[model samples]
Target chain A: MMDILSRLNNYTTIVVALGAAVLGMISGVIGSYSVIRKQSLIGDGVSHSALPGVVLAFMMTGNKSTEVLLLGALVAGILAAGFIIGIVKNSRIKFDSALALVMSVFFGTGLVLLSIVQKTPDSAQAGLSRFIFGQVSAILKRDVYIMTIVSAVLILLVILFWKEFKLFSFDPEYAHTLGFKPMRLNLLLMLMTVFTIIIGLQTVGVILMSAMLIAPGVAARQWTDRLWLMIVLSAVFGAGAGVIGAFSSSLAEKLPTGPAIVVVISIIVLISILIAPNRGLISKALRRRKSKKGWLEKGVKGGDII
Target chain B: MNPQLEIQLIAIFIATACALPGVFLVLRKMTMMSDSISHTTLLGIVLAFFIVHDLSSPFLVVGAAAMGVITVWLTESLHKTKLVSEDSSIGIVFPLLFSIAVILISKYAGSVHLDSDSVLEGDLVSAPFYRLELFGVSIGAKYIYISLFYLILNIVLIAVFFKELKVSAFDPMLASVLGFSPILLHYGLMSLVSITAVGAFEAVGSILVIAFMAGPPVTAYLLTDDLKKMLFISGGMGALNAVLGFQLARFFDVSISGAMAVMTGVTFLIVFIFAPQRGLISIALRRKRQKLSFGMLNLLIHLLSHENSEYETREAEHCSLANHLHWHEGYARKIVDKLIIEKLIVVENGILKLTDTGRTYTSNEYSKIFNN
Candidate 1:
């Protein structure tokens, strides 16, 4: 264990791992609300929409600063969310259809823009494609600092409005009658989700960002029913997956970091679903066997069994 | 055929193939399952290629079909656990399988001609170059032939199992009682979707496959309520979108698949806003018209109910009507003016009285609201 820790002592490896850990924790904490609200796939839509925003930001600024690109992504994500809301509200289209439509169109538009950017003479456009399936080794100290500050702010907001957010998530109509504006709270939650997704783009990329949001919350759900414990466990699971993913990718020769992180998180989810306490598959199977045995023994004692 | 014409033909074939099963998917409210199936099929393709050591094997389609059924089965099983909801289960399963495929392609299959990038955003320009050879001569584009074969298969299956598919989609309990197993139909349709997705994946890529699968059917859904018309219209719309999308791609010098997806969204948007019966514009207009007439009827009812009361005398005055109803003066006056023009009410001795026709109208509306 000590040898493994020392092997991971390289400065870049430590920074990248720390950044991923923070990203995973934030995704888990925020994604719990989305998952509970049954809008788990909304993150998928917002993440895909961020692509066009990133490219448009690059085109307008002619620079590759992460901050500027993510800001553009944030705006685009909000626009996509708005379009989804608009379509679902005004038309006969259901929420899932609206989500799929906006997601595909925004992503297609982004691809068209990316092709244009590739055709341009500027070579700085080279790094922009990395946002598709993130290249986490590109994380510098400054990028980590930015990630830390943004995640800190998001965590603080979530903490500050924890009760209201909980009520809003559990029952919006009840919250509305309690004079806690559900619409505003819903928007605030969306904003936080968009922020988390933007920060995570550099680590997990758009294609797999949604998995980061979903896997941890799902894993944590198996362990407990309390909201606070679920949030805490989800954050820990996410951080664990992130650290493991980053470390493994660094140790291996050809392993890609984003997919590595996703694969690790997926394993955690599978294990949780199979072996975690009362909710696990193994536990349920065992319980069923026990009950069946008890019933058979009772039947034999009553002379009802052959 | 010319390369451009061949590309257009392939696009149309792919569109129709996806749209056929897509209609049932949309009707069943399982659009997201198509998204999951398309992604997980990548795993099947990778595994099949690994086993056969060939990209063009017939077994790849079989593997992909199996994977698609597995995806649906896994999702349903997870849902049955009651721990995870349906969409969350989908989010969990596909990413896991797809990431495995990606990792496998990156780590072990790097030397092969298979590239994940082409799988994601297929290069339709090069699609025409892959010729279908039979015996000693070249026939046509390989992708076009493959897509057309699947399109025909989809049509035949849907035509033969139309009643079963419709019953299962709308009411699975009734379908099962009628001796048509809904679960079997579900897997059959899912397998068809899987095969169509694999056939189209090489030509249009996965994202556009989703667009073609859901978009045309959803647009057609807005146009008609009958399932037969919806199917025909969806297929026609799918072909139309392919041609328009191909032309748009040429005009803009963009990705052909991307253009097609965008065109599908555009057509859906247009139908959403302008469809005669179910469109947003028509619905809004109908709502506004209903509100106006409802307000007028409500005013007449109020007058009829208070025909001999002092409140009627007061409300007979122009501004008093607004005050009594707690409406703005402008709104009250507009309703009153429209009512007078319709001759539903009359001013007599500074009291509002319901005309004979107006009393009948009020009773009709009252019965419509309460008696039903």
Candidate 2:
């Protein structure tokens, strides 16, 4: 416990936690759009698809810079989103089928590429697999700066197009009938989501990153019905999970940061599902019990039943 | 038997086994469930290992299969709450379970030879070394037997419940109305998928299991609408991909399973774009042909309608027709030329006139459209 507190004041711990918190916040923000749009699992496909891009970026530039690698991840994620949309649009294959097929195939390609990179003489490729499960301890100060800038820009855009996104997410056909271009809005939303997934790859890796995108928004949704409030609450829950997860992982001897963050957020989801008002399991059950009790009492008191 | 042959046989067996259940998964739109099951089975193995303290226990398979069904049930229940959407439920459930497993491994089993990488990306090249022994006599690789067990198991279950599986997958309501329980079938299929995943995990890993599960079945779907034929073709494609992927892996000195996945994708892509009747190119070509024929019919109708009318000369001119029909000038000329070549219309001093054939065809088409 003493070691954890002393380490919390240290430079690297603060930086890593900050990075995770920012990643959580932005994922929560953009993830609300995806979750509401019923495309939450698309983030899973996009993250897996980003693997090839990260590796290809390293291969192309021979630079292990975070910005360069993430740019590559973003491009690959967009391509994956495009493929999913295209397959669902053109073929008889449903969305889930296309997502599964695309995700596995793309990750397979990444594995092949990773093997090729291993065979190469380049010693710099050693850390590339960190993107798979993530290595938050390896996150540098520069990566945090990049994440902050990207998060700011994403937030700014969300604010600027708040009304348009609101209409698009809720009722796209109505928006289209009102002369708004839903396709453009959808494309923009997908791009933002891809960007968020790419930036967070360094923290939670590809697989767990999906949880970060989903758990926060889902938890926040139980607390409120309004979209804006949900977004705000989701950001808070996500950022909180990030801090606590990062701290706990640091305190532990060999705990992995990525999965730790995911576990924390998942606990938040469980709590939200059970205890939150209105939409919570417990509250709904209580309300049902109250109504049934009232009806039974009325029946007995009025002698309407034996 | 050679080790190389054993590896190929194992790959083929796993591929065929996975493709069988994959047919139902694809048809039922639960391909993502396979993905979730593949990830959470690791947790099942871990929890089971903690209790049994034996990696090779048959109970491990049961544990993993139970975990897979639980994952599906949880996701379905979470969705049933209607608080969260189905995809969100899936996105939430698997990662949470997988993360707990990861944390447990790192925190407790870090030194117990449970490398998560090997689980996620298994090494097929090493499978031939684990020899199967039958009464003290070597019987090639153990994975070959393992995969064969799963293959036979899947084939038996699917064959025995072919009609039940078919009806439930296509129409669950009808299946229940006819005395078949969809829930029992759902859990049964989930158990089969879980065991199949466990068997294949040491060979192709979990992610490639999804490729084997979804790729072949979806590709087969594009080629045929018949369920039996789809199953046959999916299994065949899976086996073919295994052989080709093995060869490619050898040539490129890459991961064998990765190459197989890529090949699965390649085969699907080729089938998706060029299948004789149902491919993308063929579909697009069909649409184009329809458009051309519709254009020809519209041209014939226009010429027939304007024939012998006071505005015939002005309305039937190629440029005037383009303007009136709102078609591109080039498209208008092309349609007019097609009509002329078919003797449907003839130009008399820049005025278009419909022939007897054109008149009869246009009136028939017009009446048909009206009747519909």
- DockQ (C-alpha based) per candidate is 0.64, 0.78
Give the lDDT of residue B210 in candidate 2: 91
Per-residue lDDT for B237-281 in model 2, tens only?
A: 999999999999989898899899999999999998999888899
What's the true lDDT of residue B346 in model 1?
76
How does candidate 2 score on lDDT?
0.89
Estimate, for each residue in B1-372, the C-alpha lDDT of model 1 and write its tens digit.
799999999889989889989999888878878878888888898899999998878898888888998999998988888889878888888888888888898898999877556666776889789998999688888878887898999999999999999999889999999999788998999889988887888787777678888889989989998999999999999999899888998898877887888888899889998999889889989998998888888887777677677665575665577787888888778888888789988777666678899899898988888899
Model 2 CA lDDT for position B33 = 89
Worst 10 residues of 2 chain B by lDDT: B114-123
Cα lDDT tens digits, model 1, A8-96, are 99888898899889888989999899889888888777887887899999999987877788888999999988888787768777877
Chain A: TM-score in each model? 0.94, 0.95
Q: Which ranges in model 1 have alpha carbons more than 4 Å from their true place?
A: A1-3, A300-306, B56-58, B133-138, B348-351, B367-372
Candidate 1, pairs of clashing residues:
none
Q: How high is the CA lDDT of each candidate model?
A: 0.85, 0.89
DockQ category of candidate 1: medium
How does residue B110 of candidate 2 score in lDDT?
81
Query: How close to the true structure is residue A226 of candidate 1, measured as C-alpha lDDT?
Result: 94
How much does each candidate deviate at the interface, measured as C-alpha RMSD after superposition?
1.7, 1.3
